[model samples]
Target: MGDVEIRPARSEEYAAAGEVTVRAYDVDGHLAGDVGYDTVLRDVARRAEQAEVLVAVDGAGEVVGTVTVVLPGSDFAEISRPGELEFRMLAVAPTARGRGIGEALTKAVLDRARTLGIPKVVLSSLEGMRGAHRLYERLGFARLPERDWRPFPHISLIAYQIDV
Candidate 1:
């Protein structure tokens, strides 16, 4: 595995994170049809102030992956329960896949959740992302019953919860 450093995303790194997000979700051109690059960047930037946005930087200091953890708030209505944190917008660069960057980012988020005394972490993934689904399951996340809370249209989402 390459030397990976996971850290809280800085405002300057928003562009890099946006690039990674676009590339990672470009699988079969799904994200492009739903959300453009500017929208993703704007949304991520807005969320950074309230939530923890972590980025995985390579040895060269380039961001190759990112994950956002949302604390309980009005923005995350899907997670109505208490003592839980929500994760969203997880993405790894195409070249950075299989290099443990995603796992490292996830571990960082879970670590922070534990430090915050949050008992569980929740996330919703696109139904077709089988690899991501498998990784979440391997990391002890259980699939919850289907819900109608997805933000995107024509996309089926599977919710998962993991105890921190």
Candidate 2:
């Protein structure tokens, strides 16, 4: 959060934000296989319409990171319950790694939930995303093994939660 601004994404920055997301995931090998997940990842404008899309903009006005906050009623609320908030699609540009942008984006989501009086936050991550898992753990989110599930034949998602 230092020199970077974390706020709702402006319409004009949607394309940049989307590319950051796609690049982050692709660089991490999260998109090695096959489907059209990148298509969804690149649809920042649609995500902004359905949920709160937050972007981390660097001092030079570049989108360095992005995440989507899914409230209970939003279609993006995959594992979110009535009183819980869920954050999804957290991505920091490959060039921005180690700058704490991902952690800042996550904390911003937690702050949003607290502001809305939500008590808990939940999220699902691809099983191989160890870096993201470590971040969530450092933020006090615990694994909810019972809630883990497979959304597609080849895709397994693990669940994590924290009380805000």
Candidate 3:
């Protein structure tokens, strides 16, 4: 209900953002109960340089959500071309749901993509995340055929593309 600000993440905020990721995924049983803490830490370190990580902070400056946009790279080879931006991770604090934080973060990404002259933004969402799917659909993203995309671990991913 207070002011929500989205900005480029600072190096010191990685740990907090990781915590948000763990808690968000854990709520849906996507992560193991004993998932290692260092796992996210290492991931943050590895991807920080190659991605644009944005954190949403509340009026008090507490991190409440995070989204990472990874430009087309070796890891994002599934994307067709250079004009597309890939959204890697998007997580909102469980307590922050329904507050428009997720939508704000998503808009920030799209805004950045437009500023960078990217034509489209692509993201993969787990099939079970119905609310997230709806959000994407509301934002003008359509479901791409499964045959056109592939995500990891055999978990079917619903792909969405939004023109910037």
Candidate 4:
């Protein structure tokens, strides 16, 4: 991860970060049969307005991965409680996979939570995203099965949380 830098995305980089996010999800088949969510994934600027939009940039400064960090009560936050920070749309470009960009970005979120004096960080992931599930587990996130939910008839999201 030495060549990657995780930081809050700049206004000028919103389009690039959004494209990286959309491309990652599209490549991973996470968007199949899902219509409108793609628009949400591509709206980094709007999310940045209400949440923190963080990007992983390679040494040359290309946005290769992005994640949205939502605080309690934000429109982008789904399952987060008052003391928890929720992250959404965690994505790493297919071409940039295996480079630890996703893990680094997630760690950055955890660091952000600690910096804000937040106790826990939470997130929702599709049940089929086994790779991400493994990563979350490796980072000590426990499943909150009782919080699992379906936003749309075809979409089922599982929750996870880790105390920071």
Q: Work out the TM-score per prediction.
A: 0.89, 0.98, 0.87, 0.98
List all candidate RMSDs to the true structure: 2.1, 0.8, 2.7, 0.7
Backbone-clash count (model 4): 0
- Model 2 segments beyond 4 Å from truth? none
Task: Encode model 2's per-residue lDDT on 82-153: one tens digit a residue.
Answer: 999999999999999999999999999999999999999999999999999999999999999998988888
Number of backbone clashes in candidate 2: 0
Residue 100 alpha-carbon offset, candidate 4, angstroms: 0.8
Candidate closest to the true structure, highest lDDT: 2
**Regions of candidate 3 where Cα sits further than 4 Å from its true position:** 32-42, 74-80, 146-153
Give a tens-digit lDDT track for model 1, residues 29-79. 547556454475446687687677899988888999998888877463355
In candidate 3, what are the lDDT values of residues 41-124, reduced to their tens digit? 336555677777889999988888988887876453355357888786688889888899889889999999988998998888
Clashes of each: 0, 0, 0, 0
Worst 10 residues of 4 by lDDT: 35-44
Models sorted by lDDT, best on top: 2, 4, 1, 3
Mind sharing the TM-score for model 4?
A: 0.98
lDDT of each: 0.79, 0.94, 0.77, 0.93
